[model samples]
Target: MMLDKVVVSDILSRSCVVTDLVAGNKVEVIEYLSQLLFAENIISDKALFIRDVLAREELGPTGFDNQVAIPHGKSPAVRETRMAVAQLRHPVDWETEDEVAVRLVILFAVRNADSGIGHIKVLASVSVALGDDEIVEQLMQAESREALYRLIVNNTGL
Candidate 1:
């Protein structure tokens, strides 16, 4: 069976991409973005989704290199896969592999059954887009939500 390719634009919307976000810590960051998922009608239960995301974080920090943190979880509460990207006004501790404060937070949620290859493909594509220095630089310096959304969608070829 062939599954359609998943890309950033598929999950990310202009309304969900936030700039100058004011989050003090990792939990706050996730909480803020999770609200976007609920408001966008992607997740049915915000609290449940948040709990799952936090649990996934406990399993292992999603923070990686390049001051980027992609915090995500798979839960039954998710009605559809979605993403919210936030550019913080100031970096926050995410217990990243390099111990660098994360300036960009990309939050994603997926249906519980998607915990297979489909899940890996989605995350890998997002990671690959973020791995590009020019893309990351553009995202970090993006001044508006529309611009940020465009960057993600265009850079990911979604």
Candidate 2:
């Protein structure tokens, strides 16, 4: 899939944004984001989805530098590719690269049977956007769910 052809807004909306997220640990953050996907009708099974996410985390931590983490899972429990963005009320330990507590979490759920490249496209787009220090800084500083959504959608040109 072409990088420019994928837009995060296609799967992410203001409804997927969570501000003032209060997660005490990595598991709490994953479960909270998994529930959000279930609430949005993106995932049919919350338990399975959360399990897959945690399983992925066990392989390796997704936490990047600058207080950001991208925890993702591809599972049959998901009906479609979806993303949830959260800004924590306080940083939580997520085994980050820099050992800095994670304050921003981006969670993605993809259907296990998905054969198309859409999921990969979305993931690449998000990774690229997060790699930009300016964009990451803006995301970390966003005060509201609406602001967070706007920053992601705008920066990713979604």
Candidate 3:
């Protein structure tokens, strides 16, 4: 289950942006996804969804290092297994393994725990992508949303 399989262009288009994401932790990740779901007309109760996702985050932080974070949950509030990625213009403390501030956030919403494998595979793919310093540098240097998207799609085959 490559990320290209689960992360479609629409989800990528929705969340890819260069901005200062003021909320820097798990709470922020949940809120970001909730807002995305609402804005995309994918969910109605933003508060409930955000709360559930945040609660799941309490068990452990989702920060995967190399300036990336993948936060997800299996909750009824999730209408589908959707994914969205965002790049913050400024780094924010996310409490990852390397203790490096996170600049990119990937949010995933699934309706069942059985989807864990799919999510893990996607994360693995992303981790592989990030392992290439050139790829990560190119992604960070991307000037426009379209350029950033193309970089990801081309590199990840998404």
Candidate 4:
């Protein structure tokens, strides 16, 4: 998808937002998010998709200093481009530049045959919005899944 045409709604949905996710580690978090995508039919095979996500993780850290992690996977297992956002029930150590614990996780499921960096472009848009500390704080403080969904849509304008 074209960068200008991309919006947060393109990859995010009400069902994809989780406010009280409880993950003990990166693997648990990734698997949990993959399950969400699988249930939505966005990922055809959860096992393969999880492998792809882990492979991408090996390329480099997707974690940010602000208690956020954006882990993505582009694979044939992906039926659509979508994202899942979770505010963990508890924070966990992540491989971030500043070694900050991650409380928010953004998982991206991308189709392998995509024409361009559609997901990354969307991520750029999200990153820009997340740059505002106030927005990030509000997202972290969101009381429920529905509230977090609205907060992200309102702030990211996607």
Model 4, global lDDT: 0.86
Position 47, candidate 2: lDDT: 95
lDDT of each prediction vs. the true structure? 0.86, 0.85, 0.65, 0.86
- Cα lDDT of candidate 2 equals 0.85
Cα RMSD for candidates in order: 1.7, 2.4, 3.7, 1.9
Candidate 2, residue 87: CA error in Å? 0.7
lDDT of 2 by residue, 1-158 (tens): 33335578888978889998987898998888888888889999999889988898899879987788999898889998778989998999987767889888999887776546765766877888998988988888898888999899888753
Query: For all candidates, what are the clash counts?
Result: 0, 0, 0, 2
Q: Name the regions of candidate 4 deviating beyond 4 angstroms.
A: 1-4, 115-118
Among all windows of ten consecutive residues in candidate 2, which has the lowest summed lDDT?
A: 1-10
lDDT of 2 at 86: 91
Pairs in steric clash, model 4: 8-158, 9-158
Model 2 residue 104 CA deviation in Å = 0.6
Clashing pairs in 2: none
